[model samples]
Target: TKIKNEFPVFKNKVDGKKLIYFDNACTVLKPKSVIEAMNNYYQNLGVCSGDRSSHLLSWRVQELVEQAREKVREFINASSTKEIIWTKNTTEGINLIASSFPFKKPRDEVVLTLLEHHSNLLPFYEQGKRRGFKIRIIVPNKDGSLDLNLFKKIITDKTALVAVTHLSNVTGLIYPIKKIISLAHQKGAKVLVDDAQYIATHREDVQKNQMDFMVFSGHKIGGPTGIGVLYGRESLLNNLFSYNVGGGTVQSVKIHGNNIKVQYLPPPAGFEAGIQDYAGIIGLKAAVNFLEKQNQEEIADYIEKLSHYAFEQLKKIPEIKFLADYQNQIPATLISFYFSDKKVSLYDFNLFLNHELKDYFVAVRCGHHCAQPLHQFFNTSISMRASFFIYNSTKEIDILIQALKDFFNRKK
Candidate 1:
C-alpha cells in the first residue's frame, strides 16, 4: 500500500531482516512528510516565538505554532483554538488537569477505571492526595469490558471529575465515552478522556461527545515525539489555574511592596510555559493532515478484520488463552493473550518469538503493558500483545501464527 511506503522506517533493516513493527500502542513510525516538516522548520525559521521577540524569524515561528494549534483544534472538533493546550504528551496533559482543575471541597471525588495506563492513573493519585480528594476506581467486567451500571453508581454529585481512557491500550477495548460523558454531566461532574490510544485510528468529535477535556499523544498518530494535545472546554480552562508559570505564560508583572502582581494570558498560552516544541508541533500538524486524507473509519474497520483473523488463528492452539473474548468485542485493533500451559514466561516467549521470526521480522509486545491494575484483575502478571495498524497486512498475521505454531511444536 502507498501508505506503507510513506513511512521510511520500513526501508530500514534490523539484524539483516526487514523491520516489522507491531507496537502501535506504544508509538507509531513517522511518515516522511512529518519528518520533512519538522526538518524544514529546524532548517529554516527556527526561533523562539510568542512575546519573546518581534524579529521576522520569531513571527514566522509564532505563525507556525498557532497554525498547528488550529489544525489540532479542527482535528478533534474542539470549539476554538483557545481550548487547545500544547503538552509534552498524554501524561503531561492529564497531569495539567489533575493539578489545575478546581476541586472545592475536601471530600470531592475523582473517578477512574482499572484499565487506565500509568500516565492516567498516577497524576490523579498524586494530586488527589495533596488536594484532599477521594479517588474511586471502577473495576471492569470479567470480560474486560466496562460495566456501565457500576460506573453510574460510582459517579455521584460529589464527583468533581471523571477521568477515563477512551480505549484500553492492553485489551484494545473501546469504551462507551459518549455515554460516560453524558452520565458525568448529569451528575455535574466534568469528564477528562485519555484518548492516547483511540485518536490514532478513530475520529474523536469532542463537541459531539460533549467532553469537558481530552488528551492524546502525537507520537502515537504518526507524529514526532515530545508533542501532544490537550482539549479543554474554554470556560473550564479559563477558570482553572495554570499548571506551570513562567515566561510566555504571563502577560505582565508588577511589583508593589512585598507582593508582586502578575497578569496571565488566557487558556492555551497560560498553560504552556517556556519555549514549546516548535518543530514537533509543526510535524504533528503534518501528521494530522496526512491522517485526515485517509478515512479513519475505514482504517478502523481494516484493523478490526486483522484482529479477528489473528484471534481465530491463535484460538486454534489449545494452549493459548485470550485475556478477553474477541468474538463479542468486534473491531478490536489488538489482542492480548498468554500460553495457558504456564511453562514459558511471557518474557521468554517474546524472546523466542523474536529470535525465530527475525527473518520475517515479526514483532509484538509482551508485558503487563503499564496497566498493572488490569492485569491484577485478571490474576495474570503479563501477556503477549499483537497490535494492528493501517500499515499492517493479513499476511503479517499469517506469518505470526506460523511462527507461534512452529515455536510450540519445537517446544513439544
Candidate 2:
C-alpha cells in the first residue's frame, strides 16, 4: 500500500536491508498529516499562553486545543465536548482521576485487572494507599485472557471504580468490555476504559458501548507524544471536582479567611490543570482527522490482516512458543513467543538474535510489555513481540521471518 511509502522510515535502509519496524504496539509512526499540522503550528503561530492573549494568532492556538477536544469527543462518541479532558498521556489521565476525583469513603474500592499496564495499575495502588481503600484485582487465565466471572464476583456496592484495558497488550486478547461496564453499573461503580493500546486501532465508540469513561494516548494513534484524552460522562464529570485548577479553567477565585472559595469552571476547562500543550493538541486533532479520512475500520482491518499473517508465519519457527493462538479473533497488533527455554531468559536469547542477525531485520521484543501482573499468569519468562500496523505488508514480514530463521540456525 502507499501507506508504507508515506512513512519515510520504511524507505531508509539498515545494513543494506530496508528497516522493518514491527513495534507498532510500542508507538506508531506519525503520518505526514500529523507532522505537517504540528510544523504549521510552530511556523505560523508559536505563541505561548493561548487563552491569555487577545491576538488573532493566540485565538487560533486556543481554537486548536478546543478543536482537539471536540475531535476526541466525536472519536469516542462522548455526549459533550466539555466531558473530554486533555492529559499528558494515558498514565497521567489515570493518575488525574485517581488523585483529583473525589469519592465517598464507604465506596472506595478500585477494581483493576491482571492485564492492566503499569500506567493503569500504579496510580490506583497509590490512590488506595492514600485513601485506605482495598484494591481488588481480577486475574486472567494462563493464556492471558480475562475471566469475566471473577470480575462479577469482585465489583460490589463498595466498589468505587472499575478501570480495565479494552485489549490485552501482552496476549492480543480483546476484553468483554460492554458486559464489564454493564456489571459495574449494576453495582453502582463507575467504569473507566484504558484505551491506550486500542483507541484508534480498535475503533471504540464509548457512547455506543455505554462506556462511562475512557482514556487513550496520542502517540499510539499517530499523533505526537505527551498528549492524551480523558472522556467522562457529562453528568458524572459535572458532579466530580477538578483535581487541578489554573489560568482560565476557573471562572472566579475568592479568598475567604485562610481558606479559598473558588467557583470552579465546568469540566473540560476545570479538568485542564496548568498550561496546555497547544501545538501537541493541534497535532492530536490532525491525527484524528487523519484517522477519520482513512476510515478507522479500514485501517484496523488492514493492520489486523497483516498481524494475522505475521502470527501464522512466526509460528513456523520450532524454537518459538505462543502465549495464545488467537489469530482468528483479537484486534491487537501482534504478541507472541520468546527466545529462551525454561532455564533461560527470553531477553538473553532475543538479545543474541538481534546482535547476530545484524544483516537483516527481525523485529522482536522481550520483557513484560508493562503488563507485569498478567505476565505471572502466562509467561514464565518474557516473550518476544512483533506487532504490525496499516503501513506494514507481507513483504516486510517475509524479511523478518528469514532473518529470524537464519539466526536460530546459526545459534544451533
Candidate 3:
C-alpha cells in the first residue's frame, strides 16, 4: 500500500534488513506529511502564540495553533474547541484531570481497572493519597475482559470518577466504554478514557460516547512526541480548577494594595499554561489528517487481520502460551504471550529477534508494558508483545513466524 511508503522510515534499512516495526502500541512511525508539517512550522512561523504579542508573525503562529486545536476538536467530535486542551501526552492529560477534578470529601471514590497503563493508574493513586479519597480497583475476568456486572457493583454513589483504558495495550481487548460511561453517569460519576492505544486504529467521538474526558498521545498516532490531546466536556472543564498557571493562561492580572489578583482564561486556555509545543501540535494535526484520508474503519480492519494472522501462526508453536484468546476478542491489534517451557525469559526472546534475527529486522516490545498489576494477576513478571498497525501486512507476519520457527528449530 502507498500508506507504507508514506513513512520514510520503511525506506531505510537496519543492519541491511528492511525494518518491520511491530511496536505500534509503543509509538508509530510518522508519515512524511507529519514530518514536513513540523519542519514547516519551525521554518516559517516560529514565534509565540496567543495574546502575548500583537505582531503579525506571532498572530500567524497563534492562528496555526488554534487551527490545530480546531482540527483536534473535529477529529474527536468534541462539542467545541474550548473543550480541547493541549498536553504533553496521555500521561499529562490524566494527571491534569487527577490533580484538578473536584473531589470534595475524604470518602470520594475513583475507580479504575487492572488493564490500565501506569500513566492512567499512578496519577489517581498519588492524588488519592493527597486528597484522602478512596480508590476502588476492578480486576478483569480470567480471559482479560472486564466484568460489566462487577464494574457496576463497584461504582456507587460515592464514586466521583471512573478512569479506564478504551483498549488494553497488552491484550488488545476492547472495553465496553459506552456501557461503562452510561453506568458511571447514572452513578453521577465522570469517565475518562485512556485512548493511547485505541485512537491509532479506531475513531473516538466524545460527544457520541458521552465521555466526560478522553486522552491520547500524538506519538502513538503517527505524530511527533511531546504532544497530546485532552477532550473534556465544556461544562466539566469550566468547573475544574486550572492544572497549571502561567503567562498564556490568564485573561488579566491586577495589583490591588499588597495583593495581586489573576483572572484565568476559560476552559482550555486556563489548562494550557506557558508556551506550547506548536510544531508538535502541527505534526499531530497532519497525522490526524493522514489517518482520516486512510479511513479509520479500514485501518482497524487491516490491522486486525494482520494481528489474527500473527496469532494463528504463533499458535503452532507448542511452547507459546497466549495471555488471552485473540480470535474471540474485538479485532486484535496486538497480542501478548509468554513461552511456557521457561527456557528463556521474554527479554531473551526479544534479544534473539533483535540480534539473531537481524537479517529479518523484526521489532516487538517485551516487559510488563507499564501494567505490572495485570502481569501480577497473570502470575508473570514480564511477557512479549507484538502489536500491529495499518502499514503492517500478512507478509511481515509470515516473516515473523518463519523467524520464530527457525529459533525453535535451532534451540531443539
The lDDT values for all models are 0.88, 0.79, 0.88
Once model 3 is optimally superposed onto the true structure by TM-score, how far is the C-alpha of residue 78 displaced, in angstroms? 0.7
lDDT by residue (tens digit), candidate 2, 200-311 = 6778888888888789999888899998888888888887766777886888888888998888788878888777888789899988888888888888788778877877
Deviation of model 3 at 284, angstroms:
0.8
Kindly report which residue pairs in candidate 3 clash with one another: none
Residue-wise C-alpha lDDT for candidate 3, range 1-412, written one tens digit per residue: 6778899999888888778899989999999999999999889878887567889988888888889999999999998999999999999999999999999764399999988999999999999899788889999877888889987899998899999999999888888999999999998899999999999999888889999999999999999999999999999998997788997889999998989998999978898888899899989999999999999999888888887788888889888888765444643689888988776666766777777875677899998999999898887888888899888888888887887777777778
Query: How close is every model to the real structure, measured as TM-score?
Result: 0.97, 0.93, 0.97
TM-score of 2: 0.93
Runs off by more than 4 Å, candidate 3 = 325-327
- Worst lDDT run of 10 residues, candidate 3, spans 323-332
How far off is residue 216 in model 2, in Å? 0.3
For candidate 2, the clash count comes to: 0
Error of 2 at 126 (Å): 0.5
lDDT of 3 at 211: 92
Q: What is the C-alpha RMSD of each candidate to the true structure, in Å?
A: 1.3, 2.2, 1.4
User: Which residue pairs in candidate 2 have backbone atoms (N, alpha carbon, C) closer than 3 angstroms, thus clashing?
Assistant: none
Ranking by TM-score: 1, 3, 2
lDDT of 1 by residue, 62-160 (tens): 899999999999999998999999999999999999999999874399999998999999999999899888899998877778889987899998999
Backbone collision count in every prediction? 0, 0, 0
